[model samples]
Target: MEAGDIATWVGVLITLGISVATYVQSRRQARIADEANIASQEQVEAAQRRAVAVEDSLAEALRLLAERGLTEAPPTPAMSGGPGAVRWNLERRGKHSYLLRNVGTATATGVHVDRNRATPIVRNMPENATVRPGESLQFLMAPTFGNPLPGEVWVVWEGQPEAISVPLP
Candidate 1:
């Protein structure tokens, strides 16, 4: 070939080599993007499966609670009084709130907290409150101008006739 023709051929070869390199690089990048997309899809599917499992577990727990509530019977008046008398306890729920719980096997009706001797005066005491076994009544107790909060208080309920001393925990 002539000298000018040889130079032109070299330039054409260089251009062809660059085009092939760009095509190969672009194909490699496309393969990497496809792999990344597939991995992302798999992660999303796994997350969806986990969410479904959690939802199913919560539904099963709610179903069991509903079934238990349906099967249980109410306590009779005869079950209370005498040996299975209504027991009471006081718990400090927060800085100003207290929970009066019936820890006995029987239900306590017309429950009242005697704030006469207590240091912190009990406020918002429900009038004629009824507390069933394992149930509690929450009330607010705050410090007055005179005395500090005590560790124990007197609790009274209907049919008991006497006020019982309940201690705080």
Candidate 2:
């Protein structure tokens, strides 16, 4: 071929090679970005699992502590206005009363107790009682209180941000 024709052909070949290389490079970059996104999602899921594990551990610790004993003295019935400051230990059996105890370090205020069922019946126990750290409160409920159907006590403590459902024996 003539020199001009050869040069034109060479230029066209070079431009086509550069375009193909650029496309390949872009595809490689997109794959890397997708891999990074998948890695980030996996990390987030792992973190969520860890958080759930931590919450479970804390709950178990609290249950163990409550089972052991109360660390502080509880307020009197008159001062407490009656039962409701703490949750009952379903493991404990009593002829006339359920064994209630406080497991938290701080006093639980505005305690509300409810018997769980299809239709929950809130106990008429004192709503503003305070249960001291590690203290037990004998809850004398009426109508011959029986074992909980679900084996759990729903308790709301004052000064606490949220309510806790404690498992019974």
Candidate 3:
């Protein structure tokens, strides 16, 4: 063959090599992207499961507390009130959370609870309640009450203001 033919053959081989390398790189990138997507989805699912667990635990604890008489509902105006039977005025947006004291000199006897059938959540209990007479407790709540249903908390707390707190779950 002529020198030109040999040169053309070499150019063809180089072009083919480049094309194969490009294809391989593209395939590798696609695999990496898929793996990343799967991992991200798994992380989101795990977070959701954790949120459910927290809500369930809260519900169970509240139920147990009620049974054990740890939780005391507010009494009627005539029945009379005690130091431990007072409601911590809550400014809750959603999900049962501990109160940041509004304006009172009362101590936290125990955390409040919301037992809505659709959504049931409970405030964090004091490990060893150290709330001062006028100071607020330092507990935060979930962004929203993830119903064990959804929107059921509003009903239970509404009918009995003395028995239950305001709408939280």
Candidate 4:
């Protein structure tokens, strides 16, 4: 062949080789992308399985609590003995009996209700009582003919500077 023809043939061969290399590179990229997609799908499936396991565990715990006749969960204790650490409330258990509960984390010592004009006669009131967390003291309140049940009572305890008025429920 002539020199010009040989140069033209060489140019055609180089173009063909570049085209084949490009095709191969594109195929490799496509394969890598497909593999990454598959790995992402597997990760999503694993996360879904973990979520289902956690949900099943929570359901089992609730079922156990129900079987034991504990329908209500107890309150979580406070983290520290700060402003909202110590709290008290009065709950009526019966017609004459009441429960003074310490619903706080800190201990309440020397707990007593201050008597007022509208206060009823309280029986079994403990003297300088010590109530721990989640504990309660039972007392009987008898209302006379003139004085009915008080709307509220003043509660005092150790570590508390002043008496707190708790409304009756």
User: Tens-digit lDDT track for model 1 on 42-125?
Assistant: 654564466457557756876777788866443354254566468777788899788888888876767777877666565556
Report the lDDT tens digits of candidate 4 across residue range 5-115: 999999999999999999999999999968966775665456446645755776788788879999785432333576657788889998877888888887666777776
TM-score of the candidate numbered 1? 0.50
By TM-score, the best candidate is: 1
Query: Once superposed on the true structure, which residue ranges of model 2 sit more than 4 Å away at CA?
Result: 71-169
lDDT of 2 by residue, 1-169 (tens): 8999999999999999999999999999999968966775665456446645755775677677778895744443323534444433433445424546765444554565654331232222334444555655444343324533455556666545555676754
Model 4 misplaced stretches (Cα beyond 4 Å): 1-80, 117-120
For candidate 2, the TM-score is 0.40
For each candidate, what is the lDDT? 0.72, 0.55, 0.46, 0.72
lDDT of 3 at 11: 100
Estimate candidate 2's alpha-carbon lDDT, on a 0 to 1 scale. 0.55
lDDT of 3 at 72: 70
Clash list (residue pairs), candidate 2:
70-134, 71-134, 109-158
Counting clashing residue pairs in each candidate, in order, gives 0, 3, 0, 0
Q: What are the models' TM-scores? A: 0.50, 0.40, 0.39, 0.49
Residue pairs in steric clash, candidate 1? none
RMSD of each: 23.9, 21.4, 15.2, 28.6
Candidate 3 whole-model C-alpha lDDT, 0 to 1: 0.46
